[model samples]
Target: MTGKLDAAFGFHETALRLRSERQGVLASNIANADTPNYKARDFDFARALQQATGSADPAAAAATPAPALARTAPAHIATGAAGTLVAGNAPLLYRTGTQGGVDGNSVDMEVERNAFTDNAVRYEASVTLINTQIKNMLTAIQG
Candidate 1:
């Protein structure tokens, strides 16, 4: 079934998705560094990927405890924990710059640059791993 395919491919797919999402979040933060009252947002890559791939059945939780068919809406929909989404993992607070800017933006250029670099490195590493896995799979199939 589709669930099985998701479970099998989830690792690579989830990592790629998280990497892309993180890039967007980081870029946004960097772009808004000078904007007043702009709070940075990011995703918890590890937690989100774990949650997405950990379950055997992607929709199992949602399907369970079925409600009445006639009900307009279910009282509660199965939801992942808070801060588990792509943008909930951003640092809640950043230290105000010693030489604070008049705009009240606290994003330090050096810090954001370092963080972005590190994320890029990690993303590359994940891509390498996935590529190696694919190559190995191909070799096995050919043999």
Candidate 2:
């Protein structure tokens, strides 16, 4: 039964989790826009999702070793390969600056805003999908 449920909701479950995590990263980028030397960080959602779903070719996966996000402190969460969470490590990639600032901050308000909004919409959509699936399951059980 648990396996069946996992199979039913696996994709959306992973997607929703990744979306929420990405939302946090985007928010952090926005919050640190004014901070000097702050590099905007993000991850490849499609690639992460692909990795999480175990659909990637083994050769490709082996070729790319998981890279860690730059951490300011020793206690920060360690990031690694996409879609595989090992002790809170999420794969984070630094965003390249479109326009360099005097203070060396890489965050662009326009880009962050757009990405934030898009991630939020996708998150909401994932929630809606999960809800619909649950409702359908309940209806079937009742019938």
Q: Which candidate is the best by lDDT?
A: 2
TM-score per candidate: 0.62, 0.83
lDDT of 2 by residue, 1-143 (tens): 99999999988888888888889889999999999999999888887888878876779877877753566698977644334342124357789989999999999999999999999998998899899999999999999
Specify the highest-TM-score model's number.
Answer: 2
Give per-residue lDDT, candidate 2, residue 69: 50
lDDT of 1 by residue, 22-97 (tens): 7776777799888997655655566556555664344744553223323336775643343224532222233445
What is candidate 2's TM-score against the reference?
0.83
What lDDT does the true structure give each of the candidates? 0.63, 0.83
Worst 10 residues of 2 by lDDT: 81-90
Global local distance difference test of model 1: 0.63
Instruction: For candidate 1, give the lDDT of residue 136.
Output: 88
